[model samples]
Target: MNNKRRVTVILAMAAIAPLTFTACAGGGAAPASGGDVKSLTVLDSYNNDPDKGILQASIDKCAAKVGVTIERTTVPGKDRMQTVLQRSSSKTLPDVLMLDNPEVKDVAATGALSPLSDYKVDMSAFAGNSLDAVTQDGQVYGLPLPADTLGLFYNADVLAAAGITPPKTWDELKAAAAKLTTGDQYGLAFSAAATYEGAWQFLPFMWTNGGDETKLDSPEVKGALQLYVDLVQSGSASKSVINWNQADVKDQFVAGKAAMMINGPWQIPALAKVPGVKWNTVQIPVNKPGQTPTAPLGGMVWTVPRTGDKAKQAKAAEFVACTGTEDSQMALGKARNTVPTQNGLHQKYVSEVPTMAAFTKQVEDARSRTGKLGKDWPKAATTIYTAVQLALTGGASVDEAFSKAAAG
Candidate 1:
């Protein structure tokens, strides 16, 4: 079974009582009853930001076009996870939900969202193994909407000031870091702290080394760890990167304190706003020759909550699938710089956001982080990352890092 199709089948969340279910139902399924049920709810993690405004508009447009009356709510993504857990425990799950991949796995373990495997739709139009990212226990739990990847976002002026070209390989990146470091200025800003941001940047390196994060004992993973250690211990990077309770790496990059960073497409608009800043983006480079450039995929997805009303759930699923189709995707393309997950929409978004095209293409060729890793990924990723950080920071040996982390 190609890793893309290795869906998780475990329904471990049965321990938490399934939440009360109801699909968008004041109206009938399919053709509908001319108008949508006036009182439907969607819970998402867009608590007041660009994602909030754009996503709410998208929801309103889709729901209105379908004649469905829908209400929306926003919560922090982390808090949304707790909401899913709480709702699963209290039986108050929302009718619709928005989540990213890791949260999808955590929520799936609780059996709260409806699986769309039975929903009729072709999967060939999507990118990366994004569809696979949301598959759990051999079932489709969510629909990946916009696909994205992490990349090196550099202030063109910063690199230009230092007279260095963009680093083409990890080794070049380190060398450039040394040359670029100056008073209050760093050549690189990465998410090395113990948080989601840390893993976001670190995972791509592990993938470039040809190691699934699920296999922490692999040599590739170890080599990736050593690279990170070399960066920090050798003064190529700052040790304060590990300081807790923040995601300010991008902030540093944007303010010109750092010359480059590993961030997703979401950072583009904000970075563009910084004056006198000429920035360009590129795919995260591999360690050396013969290895492909790697980028850990990231993106948002839509899903219907598992409900007692099977027919309504079915209706909602179809609508969700419709939102993923080529037409809706193209419509989305017309309005934003977002690349559509649909087959050809990539070309379209590339033209629209030309400067960011290379980064998007990297994601297209990038392999999905799946299989065993897809199932229990969050825990495994944290375990391996923490272990690697320990060794890189001089707390453990390379072998000891693997041995201690793999002891699980």
Candidate 2:
């Protein structure tokens, strides 16, 4: 369930009247001397995402345990919430806000987020790249709730009928794809249109080949892109995938229109539930023999905004601290098919969504986005997709497209 929000700064109840902002750090980062314990405002884009809902629920759960209630305000998407928060620099930019993995550094660059590392929370305990994505300039900036990795999805029945095993090495994958191309089914599927899905879908290829969007001209880049071109030119890939968007590809993959796809941990639950269908996940085919598995990291974090409401900031900080635990976080993995940033999420997730365990295994070796973090990361991804789309149109060579893209 992506339905989550980062609940922040409650402003009601406590031993006080109405509530006035109080500021200051307590010993070992406790709530300030004077604070409001009654109401808090959380800014989040999860209202539509639903996947981020765990954050809001956790805050509410923890608040009850500690005796506090939260008033959450959800934004439609990243742009809307970031716009509001940016404009409200002088005003309190909602007590807490949602921060995606790639945007952690950018948001911190604005000097808006309060450092959780300086507070009561111990940063290292978080799972995966939580600390890397949120830490900026050697300071912790935000707290990521869900952490995920990218990989390939397959229709188990389809693979079984074809008498094929999941490919373990990159070379084997190509041969398998060649073998699996029995009919309308393609050995693999990926989006090529200039968009998020198209761009994100290409990352695994990039990573496996030792290339990334940032270094699109590397030889590995050429080899990786060649695979996509082969998938299309050989009529083993779907053209609609290029521009139809992410949801389209997922629906198609789930409906059995395609045999395999590259995706993130977020889709694990829904994919597992495909009725009368057998589906399984596996890491992207490896590039080098005996090398560790690889994938692109995905997910978001929670951050607090400072507006002179020291009490509100302190409350938001504590609420964030509540959800950053390994137990609570991995427990979430069971519920959402998401991976926690902490290490202990293994047993928790294995018990709930076993199919996802392979996906989570990549966390220790997965790579985050190479481009600098920013609220605009999605925009950059879009730009890269544009290059993919243009190349897929058969208008230019993959090298030309990426070369042009790199310069662009």
- The clash count of every prediction, one per candidate, is 9, 23
lDDT of 2 by residue, 1-408 (tens): 232322222222443443343433222442343555676677776665445576556667766754557777766664754565564663557677776667667767778778876566777666535577777777777887767777777778888888889888777777777777766667776656665657777777777777755556678777777777776776677666676665666777887777777767676556656776677788888767765666667776788766567777788787777777765676666666677777765656666767777877876567677334445566557656766776777766887876566556
lDDT of 1 at 289: 86
What's the TM-score of every candidate structure? 0.85, 0.83
lDDT of each: 0.71, 0.69
What is the TM-score (0 to 1) of candidate 1? 0.85
Error of 2 at 234 (Å): 1.2
Model 2 residue 376 distance off true place after TM-score fit, in angstroms: 8.6
Compose the digit string of candidate 1's lDDT tens values, residues 299-361: 677888875656556666766776787767655544444567655677777776687587667
User: Candidate 1 overall Cα lDDT vs. reference?
Assistant: 0.71
